[model samples]
Target: MSETLGRRGFLSAGIAAAISAQFAATHNEARAIEPIERNGQAKFKYSLAAYSYRGLLQGKAAELTMHDFVSDCARMGLEGTELTSYYFPADVTPEYLRDLKRHCFRLGLDVSGTAVGNDFGHADPQKLREQIEHVKHWVDNAAILGAPVIRIFAGHVPKGGSADDTHRQMVAAIDECC
Candidate 1:
């Protein structure tokens, strides 16, 4: 059975996990994150983001792939992992996505989420539409990979464009992406 969470639920889990990881790292403490108890059961989980291995994957440190990142997280005993989209090859196919998901499943890790870099501040309607389409494509891939949340960001405002206008454009682009 697929264990994918809904977007909102996954966002909540991913954010809490990220904050917990940061706190633990900076404080040099054990995994002391207190779980949110509900009916005497823990509600939150801890995860490692693949982006944390960016330098290694991008050739700045050591050679690695997303699969290696998953293995490292499993070795570190994380409960979930965020598969950052930046490290994926440009021509990623459905077969590749299926393999990735299967690998995570075999390692007993949740595909916490994925992320994309986008600019929705373009003044040109065509450009904005293209950007939305690009994001939508990733959304489909995320679903296929059993990932619940796909984080997207509105880039810096275009030169001379008003913040209000950019904000509206971003909203429109997001709406279309959804």
Candidate 2:
């Protein structure tokens, strides 16, 4: 009888240990799967938008150049600025990009990103391909400028095209660009 009692106690202990181990493992996995909130208040480096100088960029009223924009960003205590592609010359060379990057670095500013207008929702396949190519070109330019991101836009859907088709086409175009 005593032996029977000892065996019963040992078996019960072993079962309890196994159950506890499983519970611990499950608890850790549950914690690991907890959703992350990315929209909460988080400190980020301040950046300026070169698009704000549209008038200057277009040579309308002010003649503030891209270099001047970078200098102004530095003077205003900004960490970086978006270099909009619209303001750039059509004949941008590799040397020009390198020099601009160096100038920004010298001024303690970063080329945060570059923005280019893209219309991926066009019904015409040729137009869509052209837009995709345009985006791709800017992506390379952004890399050359040492910019970390390239902001792209999908224009409004064409009159005859369905929203779903347009969305799918945009996704495919972006995939090709990437």
Candidate 3:
């Protein structure tokens, strides 16, 4: 019994040591990718989409404002970001857009674009027009933030509706925004 216990303990210690060594190796590998700053320049550049971190934000793991999100992007070695309208405190204002641009500039991260959530496939002309206006509003905000692209979505096709009609409505909305 004593010999069996000693063998089991030795095996357990060996397994623990192997796991610890693997953990240390993995940690060191991650650290090797650490951002480097030389002559006020970073060695690597990447882009982050706000949607990528939505789980953290909505889960309350992190209370991140737009500015804070941009800073986080910089810290993660990202040089660009795609801003989501949901993260903004309110309707995009010129002042707020300016501030966001400034914050990104200070952090050395560029606002690559804005993701505007607008569904413009409504059957009602009035509703479609409203959604178009919403898209244009975000496009304007994107322009203010020096974003080159504005991501837009085509709303779902309603059941029992003509596919042609839905396509026409989407085209009209696109024209209106343009």
Candidate 4:
């Protein structure tokens, strides 16, 4: 169980729960999101961003872990979760990743994906390459987690840099990562 979840986290989780309850009330006949059938009608599944629960995950309420995040999502009847990369241990290991995936599976939740903040808009070529490598690393991590999507941020233009040049650098960096 979550430890009080702090006042803010508790309030936020309660609000999310209330919204989920309202949605469930409206879709009383909704089918469980797992075991998708190709021939069945398309339906959207909800996922919560781990960033939304940063307070519980990493703030003073740091007793919370990613497993708790997944459990909370399941309790809300969510189909998936977005495990943002910033919250992972500094020295994340393959065992840790596999455990997370297993936990999500046990809870009938999908990892959905992870996210990374990047600066492909770096003015310097070296810095841009570093950003690209960073993205690639997360790409590998996401693959291990069986996450189908990874939301990444393309940083804003650097000071004194033209928008066009920054766009070019960002595009090139993305190309390299791809």
On TM-score, the candidate that comes out on top is 2
Ranking by TM-score: 2, 1, 4, 3
- Worst lDDT window (10 residues) for model 4? 28-37
lDDT of 1 by residue, 85-165 (tens): 888877889999999999999999999999987889988889888888889999999998999899999866888999998
Steric overlap count per candidate: 0, 0, 0, 0
Q: For model 4, how does the per-residue alpha-carbon lDDT over 1-178 read when each residue is reduced to its tens digit?
A: 3666687798999999999999998787575466656887779999999999888777545867888888999999999999998878868888999999999999999888899978888877788888899899999999999999988887889899899988887787888877
Q: What is the C-alpha lDDT of each candidate?
A: 0.86, 0.89, 0.84, 0.87
TM-score of each: 0.74, 0.75, 0.70, 0.73
lDDT of 3 by residue, 20-81 (tens): 99999999998787566577654664788898878655444567677878889998888899
RMSD to true structure for each model, in Å: 21.7, 6.1, 15.4, 22.7
What does the lDDT read for residue 10 in candidate 4?
A: 83
Runs of candidate 1 with Cα error greater than 4 angstroms are 1-37, 59-62
Top-lDDT structure, candidate number: 2
